[model samples]
Target: MDAREAYSIKVISEIRLERLGLLYGETRIKDNDYVTTVYLKDKPILEGKISLPKFIGDDLYYVKSEGSSALMRQSLYGEPQKVVELGKVLKYEPHGKGLLILGEDPLTKAEKDAPLVTSKRKYRFDGRGLLRTRTSLYLFDNKLRKVIEGDFDVTDFSTNGKRIVVSTSQPDDDVGLNALYELNLDNGEMKRITEKEGSIVALTMNENGEVAMLGHDRGKLPWAIREVILPEEGKRFVCGNTCGSTVLTDIFDGAKERLIFRGDEILTLGQIGGEVNIYRISDGKTEKLTHGQHVVRLFDYDGESLVYSLTRPDKPSLLVRKDEIYDPNPNFKGAIPEKVASSIEGWGIITGDNPTILFIHGGPHTAYGYSFFIEFQFFAQNGFNVIFANPSGSQGYGEDFARRCVGDWGGRDMQELLQFVQDVKKQYNLTKKIGVTGGSYGGFMTNWIVTQTDVFSAAISERSISNLVSMCGTSDIGFWFNAIESGIEDPWTVESMDKLMKMSPIYHVGKVKTPTMLIHGEEDYRCPIEQAEQFYVALRSRGVEAKLVRYQGDGHEHARKGRPENMIHRLSVKLEWFNAHLK
Candidate 1:
């Protein structure tokens, strides 16, 4: 697509979706830039005014405009009715006789100036702009007036008309995991429902307080659907093994209890097995409904059929319908790489070989899957064998496996990754030079690897975290990201800071010998570009070959959804850097 032709469309809501009537919002290129508009099917109904539209029931809809704190209510055809003012909303849903707004409150002068860490050391955070604010939950009545409020970060919630089940996490926990809480809409009371060790991914409750949830327990335990006869007492039994990431879950009564969920159909990285699929669990039997290589998202299940979207490696996303084929760019032929699934000492790898790049996926919570990735195909086309692995910290594995890297970021995780490389080398008997690259957490791994050993001639670290201590004060979510993994309650004390420093690659920069390329997005607050800068400077000062490549006006996700040309450029830079140094 031309720079002047890029566009995006989002479907509004599922209120009356079964009736087959649809409302969509579009953001498209105009005057060589992007502007948002709303549409009714194929007709352009509203333009150059509103964006982020959400349907309210069947007759009304809500939309918010840029730089405005008010959400405008409008009719189906585009007539505006009323403007409802609210704080910046991060997430919300329709709730009992009103709207539920979950966002952050405006920071006060004293609060804004307060140090993030309660230490007397005066850490360097000034001029770094405002820190990420804490989120709170607010209830707006049917009249769109504020009714109830609380200081909690609501991650997930499900309502049953009268009651609501919310998953919330406090900032001080530093673990970044949410626990189940029950919110009584009638009395405006909230109570802790589950006090378990693991995070609650999905939850639903009956009037009796009996609950069913998709739980990801600490370390090695895979996400599972569990039944809690006494949820308020925090007791639960695993009902079914959910091999994949559990995204959504619900329950229904019958002769036997049954749970319906939409999650990954296969647990593997998609290199060898399945996709994000829908399932039904009844009588302790889990049955998968759809099958294919494509990633699937289940929206609503009508008694007759399920409304969904399917996306594959070679095509754009398509809604499940009579004519669902969509290929936005048909000119270029698809690059289909062969799938090679292997396990080295229990760790899994989707393999490619010699002149190969051992790519690590980010998140530690996010997995590399069978879904289409343009970057993978580009590397394969350029004659690079790609071997991406799910090490101990990767999500596709059970929660225990993922939890194994929590307090040991560069320890066992690095060892397992190294073993994966050695095993792949021996299996393929490759003599060619090897390269390595990864973004975010994977980027941190790349930095750690180069410092630990120079087995690889080249390394590319993108959007990385080099110094955990400095990062805690800079990156948007740096505070919790460090605390949770370090198992430290406060990151400012000398002991905790020492631990963080030891874990950071910057502390070991003098050991790095591999020729490195440090790439980052300038505006990335997640792992700020300063991370890349410091690493690059340290490498260069140590007489190691290094280059810093920064993408302008781009954030953490530049490679995936940034400007088209910028994405291509980022990939091209990676290829060029590897091609130049790998040999």
Candidate 2:
């Protein structure tokens, strides 16, 4: 790596991730002298983006990012050009404005004269939030009818908007933990809409009016979204989880009034599979949108084109756009590549012209999405078409699929995944020198893949689990979840820990020949640092070409939230490793 490449996270090294504290990201390709960054400033810390010339200097500073509130400008150090306080507006506002997400020790009498600096809270997710156990909500609108709040959670609407429903929850065990309640926008009466004991996963309302869908916490399979009964006449599909992949497109009415739009192997937000099928409420005629198998997730459907994301083995999420459907396959214009199916069997293909891929997504439950992935795209942008699959253990599918990896961690699931990779490579005719990498469970798989086979030329394992015996105790989640996932209560008992060791990659390190890179955080409690350390130690001891990167102060999500320097360093090392091996 070039020495000129210097970058830092906006937060101080000793600082931990705060709920509302500003986080900054920057990348300077030193050899190219191009500095690209994203940041959010203090107080107004929402999100910011940076663009610098190929050349660098003191004048070469400042990053601009548009947030939910306003666009912000700040120095690389996160010093803002102006100070403007927002009203702290929130939707589905939780914890109330009164809840102290971040705190500071009471200022001493002498310290009162000094500026009062506060500490940031640890949990803050603007999109979908972490669901604890299920709780009830009382939806009561303000006297004005436009504002509504319920048992600690609230939703506010414009004064003109009619009756509204607000969703709220009480803090419980983190899972699909929130219940969606219907509120009378006028009378302020609330009724719980979700009937199942499990939490309602997501909510979607259509512009056509009177039409809505709610996806529930189904078994973690390919996700499946259920339709809700609306009034006496209209039936709508709920938009929570679609059975196939993580990225389920929004639900909508089909060409016929009674037919509901949905598809298996969905690729985009509004668009679905190769044969777009409309399910009829009256008789259930499954009409096809197309005649072939295609991958999909998010897609724009109104006037000009349809856009969406897709999932397949060897890739994660992909973008596809089409002018019209049903006539001919979309031919992406220049700058965008045509989509192709995976080489793996039993997997769908994605539409794109990106390079051949080696995608590594986190979560045995998490799949790829439209959300910004700063680190993943580095390879995609550099000519690697990304690919990955659920392989029966991903979330969004249903509980059955997700739980499949529960007690049976190293069972048929991994074997199916191995088959998936091999099938994808064989079916797609991708290079034999495949690249593999992942984080957490994915990282575990990266380690497992190398030990199981030498098919991949290069591998990257981040925040991985190398030894279950050590991790089950050291992890913060050790107190409760190990029993649930490992099928045992005792941490070190021979039977329980023995099964864990069976799934651990540390025991198989001696069999690895793939040039591997280990990336981990110093503070990751979920997988713990020992997991990475054990694997690295084992690999190095066996004389396998391997490197260990420990990001100071980082936890499980080391890559995204790791210190900026570590981010750049990890990326550089990974890219170099990939370039040397895959390229």
Candidate 3:
């Protein structure tokens, strides 16, 4: 009954030719029944809900049940945001009035909750910013007196409610890094408070609503906690990990306010790994409340217990937080992977510890979990160790760890990975016969890693960028973000190009000694196949064992998005290559 044995050569080839073009994966809603999303022309996006599941995101979230699905979109007012999704009658506050956002869903149930959000537009700043969700106002409503709404951005509040602090008209422009301000609730006056540049990672507000404490990004993570008293100098705290493992701490451990919070990174110190809680600072004595694996950064702490989401691995490719984590009818049917070791926070070998380790991941920003990364679990079922780590640049921790790769991709991130692999060896008793595989940034890392080190016995680089100069213009996002994020844009600029080439694996293909495999969809725009083709040709020309895999019309995420059978085929080929090279 082996899953790999179920696929026939003919079946896989048929899938490769037919199904490997679009997002055609089968989700097993019931036993042997497959489901996938249907984004028909002008239709509300629908996923087969035979078993009924919920989909949650940062703001735009939906919870669909047996026949009826309820959606909640954040109102322009504050947090505890609300959206309307009563059978696709998408009623949302577009500008002033509640208009139809999503017309209607074909599938309807008997009844649903249609609570109309009464808009009380308390305009302060002229809404001249982007209509993007990031700028949309989100706050926990405490001003109206009742717990009706909000959990808004806690970064821009004052200590007295009279004068609000806000940056200048060009606040966000130079705020390339740390930019926060306070707005006067009464006069609608913006006070240009702190001029730090970096992404604001976390923020917490005091009971008075006067003091909006912020957690600014520190290039190195676990973040060092700092409380910026609005329009004044920030107060730095020595919080975070001293070592590798996570230790629970109280919330108000740093300040005089006894807001018992458990944080690994107190925003100023090192990463003291553990979930952070700040339910009640309790006369300055810290008490750790809330039981969940990941720490819910205080979105906003009211006068009562700290209100935040609870995150844990309970489903496929889905990290559940808040109430959704405790959904009665959860998504996944099998067990998700738990932390294997303290030091290695998000990286570990699958417990079943399958031998053919097919370590697959993307992002260099995306973290792997028991959530909906089905391919990892499938690899585990197919007898692979399946090691994944949230390395330096992955999200979910905070701004610090996420920014560690800025201007330094192969330096610290690579070292952490080497340590991660060593940790895997110790934790999972893994051998050096490791198979390194990934896509996009991950694939870039795979290609980059093979060129620099012989740590992995075999490498599979899928849809990766091998040349930095070429990638600058070729990639869909190459013009700006890819460089700014990587701390390397304008590849043509002598200095920037030097930085790009320094990190690019294509520059030093002579160093690669491992047998590697290159897989790509011909139409991939993110990391084109030309990079893979060049690497393969070099490896083959250099008398090293290498193979190139190309799929027609498949883009960057096609291997996962393509048809079910093609997906199964990609799985088969990846595993087969690892079996031939790693096993």
Identify the leading candidate in terms of lDDT.
1
Report every candidate's CA lDDT. 0.58, 0.45, 0.46
lDDT of 1 by residue, 1-583 (tens): 2211222222221111324354444443344233555545545556653544566665444545444345666665667765455445544566656776655555556876776763312222222234335455667664543333433346566554456777776422334466666777667677876555455555554434345565544522222223322355344343222333322100000011122322311111011122455454434445566566655532344334454544455433345543454332455443444444345222222234448788877775555544445565567666777776667666544446657788788898888778777777776676788888898898999999998988888999988989999988887667766777776878999999999999999999999889999888878877889999999999998899999988887777765545545665677778789889764
Model 2: per-residue Cα lDDT over 1-583, one tens digit each: 1311222111111111223232333233333222333333322222223321111122122223223121123444655542121212222211221111111112234643554342312121212222111122222222111234322333211111332443454222222244545555346566765444233333333333232333333322223334343322344332234322343211110011111222221112222221122122223222223222333432323222233333322232333334422211123111222233442223223223323445545556555433223443445555564555555555554456556677665566567666666666555666535678888777877888788887788898998877777766666554345555666666667787777777778877779999899988877767777888888888888999898988776666556534455666777888788878777
lDDT: worst 10-residue window of model 3: 9-18
Q: Which 10 successive residues of model 1 have the least lDDT summed?
A: 248-257
TM-score of 1: 0.73
Each candidate's TM vs. the true structure? 0.73, 0.54, 0.53
Q: Model 2, residue 14: displacement in angstroms? A: 34
| Top-TM-score structure, candidate number | 1
TM-score-superior candidate, 2 or 3: 2
Model 2 regions lying over 4 Å from their true place: 1-164, 169-171, 174-176, 182-193, 204-213, 217-360, 366-390, 394-406, 420-434, 468-495, 510-513, 521-530, 541-544, 551-569, 580-583
Q: Please estimate how well model 2 matches the true structure, expressed as its whole-model Cα lDDT.
A: 0.45
